[model samples]
Target: MGGTLRVNSLAIQDRRGWQKPYELTGRLVGIIGPIDRGKSSMVDCIDFVLGRSVRFKGAVDDQLVAVKAGMQIGDEEVFLHRSRRRLGVVRVEDLAGDEIATVPINASGDQQELSDWLLARLGLDDAFASVRLPHDRRLSFASDLLPYLHVRQEDIDRFVIRPQTSADDAARLAVAKLLLELINPASERLGARIHDLNNEIRNKQRKADQVRDFLNASPETNSGTLDADLDRLRDDETQAAQRLKSLRDRARAATQFAEQRQQQVDRARQRLATAEDGVDWALRRHREKATALAQIDASLAELGEVAAASSEDRERLALLYDACPACETDLSSRAVPTGRCSLCTETLPGAAQHKEKQQLQRARERLVPEVAELEQNVTRARHAADLAREQLALARRAVDEDTADAVTPYVDAITAAATELEALRSEITTLERLKEPHRRLSERQEEINRLSEELDQAREQQVRVGAELNEPDDVLQRLNNLFGRVVSEFRLPWATGRARLDRDTLLPMVDDQDFDQRGGGSRTAVSVAYSLTLMMYALEDPTRFQLPQMLILDSPQKNLGRNDHDQDLATRIYRWIIDYFEVRREALGGRYETFQLVIVDNNIPTAVRSGFDTLIQFKDPHGFIRDLDHPHGEPAGYEQLALDDELDHDGL
Candidate 1:
């Protein structure tokens, strides 16, 4: 008991309900119960608590909360508690109930804490993280190794540890690698190194290609003819410089002539200004004089008409009688006075009237002379204005003609020289830009030279590593032989004509027949033989094996005990495994530590049950879930309650 490393017990607890704690224990524990009685549930709970990678497909009660398992790895006893409420979290504790660690089962690095702790307890080194052989992902998790410890009912017919239905082909290859690495840890290290080297080689090759592409696309520059090209460019530059200087000298001379023409234009503009002012003044004077002359002539004509009417009025007055027509007064002797008309009887001063007529005639005569004099002055002013205008026009025309003759040649020379210089400058800029690609080509060539050297060294290293990557064939052969011998010892229906395990498939082969061709019973027998063979091989060298020396198989009796013959064969198979363990112990002179085997089935043969160290049986409604009022292994007290109720009815 002290030497053996095995599970001591598995306990299920429901703190929220009336269900009591149900526990199963011992090395060869047989949980015998009928179908749908929580038999498979008990197996699933144990697997869950142990962190096995099997899907739970068993009965679950709403009241169930968590499951706990206790196992002894070597000399250390540990407890694992897994809560159904928190499916992936596992809490580890010592036998004394001290918390050792809490692990979350996830696909992250922190989740590996549980796996690392478990491997330490099982006396194995920590598996490298994310290390894989070719064509496989990293398969170093603690759960990844659980397949070897437990024989899952769902994958019982499968050849490898996990079923092809649940696991892919890559997982099977990983299992083979895991086995080989267990025998030779160097293979794992070598594989990881080889993977790194391959990546390095690819990365270097890509860089080299990039450099080569850059070199290939480089623009060609004729360095051998560079001197001749430069000499030609220098000659072009010299000719351009000389032409530019000559044009500049001519432009300076023409600029001086244009300045002289501008001076002439300025003088002409001044003269035009003076002439325009003079013409404006003269025209205004002429208009004022003509208006005066017109007024004078009108006054002279009016004076002449007034003189004639006055003469006629005087003659009539001399011939008329000296009486007023209206009064008929006898005033013949009263003469018509000078200031008064004779017919009106009002007298005026004759001398005064005559003087007024004389004054009128004199004023008319003086205006005519003044008008003539002003008209003569206006004519002279007009003649002088016309002469000034003619001189201004001549000056403006002379300025325009001089500007056209002198400035136009200088403007044309400057434009032609500037256009030629701009074109030459553009050519020089294009030549400068073309040289940049030549510099880039040299840089790429240097990079390619350096990378080529490194590539050669990496290739040599990769080749050496590849040579060491020989397949682990010898150890696989030994494993196959052991499995074949175990299959033969069981003597199942399919175990005939030199039975053996196929190295590639990891399944039993009877002569040339594969495990898939066998009947269900034959396969079951062969599967059990293989499971036993693995445990035996691990126990032979526990230090080198990564699998724990414990196996939990659920419901092996389904195919094993379908009929009388199968039942007999199953009985023999059980005895054979037990005897195998006993022989190993005996061979070691009681020094060998036997491993654990937990069998869960509905039918446990009476003889086989007797040899088991622990036996738990399910009957009636008394299962892992116990009734609150009526516990297991005890009859319900309903009869007593009914009797008391009857008495109360009769008033007892």
Candidate 2:
């Protein structure tokens, strides 16, 4: 058995915003509240943070944005966070706030990333990663053990595990085997050895099946003729290969000559295309130059007319007045204008006019040289265009001549040889296809032999493990002895007379009836009794059980509320857990805390409530999400209507 899991606190927060963590503490924690006061939700929060497979129910409401929890598992602490909107995502963090890992919460079977990670971090042995059951079935710890740790309210009437499918039933059995192993090291070793042997046997069986399928898919073979047939096929393949090699050698020289001629033709074609492009580009440049020359000539003509008009205007202005154009006044004889023309604002200069005319004449002279250069450029461009066109034509002629002489004959010859080569390739393909069945027949026979040998070895090992498995049932007997005492004390009434734990189901059988068929009160009593027995057995000998040493029983009183006897039984169940811890602590002299038990329910007897180490009461406005106020009045449990059982089915 493992040491007790003393959960110091469970701190939950909304990941979307900064809310104070809803922290609950103590070894014997009791979530006490009225019906629907979020007691069940609190239990869910604890289970979720500790890696329970079922989704937290009552805690996840529409107002809840996200759910995150920080908890101490034994001595190590970890933080878990999940979004309400995205149920499948979860993030885990260390105490220092470093992200440890994030995983999809609902990963498929055999893809248990988050579960496996948590299992490793919880310090569980890797050997427990997978467990084998009878009929060659295997179960993952995530799907089996975690569910059993926290039994649901609806599942109280069911067995230790409420399996929803056949696969789940097998997983439950595997979990039973695992629990048994914890109490018996001999059983664990034998089980592990047997599992490994079974795995090897399965592998061998698979190979044998594959070999049989391969042989069945192909033509039947005679062992005596196989070698002879292979040799004949190999010889034919070799002869065909040799003929192919000879043909290739003979064609090599001509093929190389053809390739060289083709390369020459390709180069010629490229050069011709380049020259043609050059010719077009030069022609375009020549046309542009000619247009530029025409524009220059027109610009010069416009400049000459503008100059003549300007000279006439200067002469007329000089005759008009040496006057300012601002005001009309006669000042023809004045050196400087005193009166100005009323129509225009100007101070006319006689010497400056002649300087402007001289500047125009200089500009005209510059245009004449530019126009001549453009004409010369146009002529040069035309000549380049003509040379490029001639070069392109000459190149085309050379390519045509090469094609007519060297390339044509070789291309015809190569094409004929290629056709013949393709025919030989087809023939080779047919022969290989014909040889395939024989090849498969030989390989399958070899595989069958190998598998047969391995299967024999696996069977021998399995038998050895079986012998080891049969050594003794001392540990099981010890467990049952404890279980028997607990059930007898609980006093679950059966229709027949006697009640005992079924060795196969690991559940209580009353009067040869299954646990699920019993009355609600009896069922609840047996369930609690079963849990207490497991704790008592492990606490008696910590080395014998690998349970986490913590049990979370949610709303056990729901199904046991009908009569005083049943209620008394529920009270006893709670008192038993608290008393067991107290006695163990006293005996150990405060040296160790060996077990922790949590009971979550709407109703807790006053005595039971007072005796607990910790109590969290949800009343009035205070509930699961402490800060957020509920809008639809008081958050009430579904007391008015019958609630369906949440039978969570983990499937393949």
What are the models' TM-scores? 0.55, 0.54
**Model 1 quality (TM-score):** 0.55
Candidate 1 residue 246 C-alpha distance from true site, Å: 30
lDDT tens string, model 1, 1-652? 1124467777776645434445555456788876767677777776676665445443355445787777776567888888877777788899888998787765374456555556555544434343454455445434466666666666666554655543445555555455434323444455555556566656756765665455446443453343355567767777777787787786567556556556656766676676667666666766765664455455445434544665535322233434566788854333332334445645433333444344434544655666676567657666765776676577667666765666677677667767777777676666656655545655655665565555566566655654554344655576677777777666676446476666666656666777677777676666776777767666775433445667877766546656877777778777776677667776873324447788877777787677677888887655665543333224645543455777889998
Q: For residue 23, what is the lDDT in candidate 1? A: 51
Kindly list the per-residue Cα lDDT of model 2 for residues 81-189, writing each as its tens digit. Answer: 7655666767777877788777765577666556565555544545355454557543443466666667666676565656546677766755555554532334444
By TM-score, who's the top model here?
1
Top model number, lDDT: 1
Query: Listing every candidate in turn, what is its Cα RMSD in Å to the true structure after a full C-alpha superposition?
Result: 21.4, 18.9
| Residue pairs in collision within model 1 | 338-350, 339-348, 339-349, 340-347, 340-348
Off by over 4 Å in 1: 1-5, 15-25, 52-59, 107-112, 123-125, 128-130, 133-142, 165-167, 180-186, 203-471, 504-508, 513-517, 589-594, 627-652
- List candidate 2 segments past 4 Å from native: 1-6, 14-22, 50-60, 85-89, 96-112, 132-142, 182-450, 460-472, 494-497, 589-594, 627-652
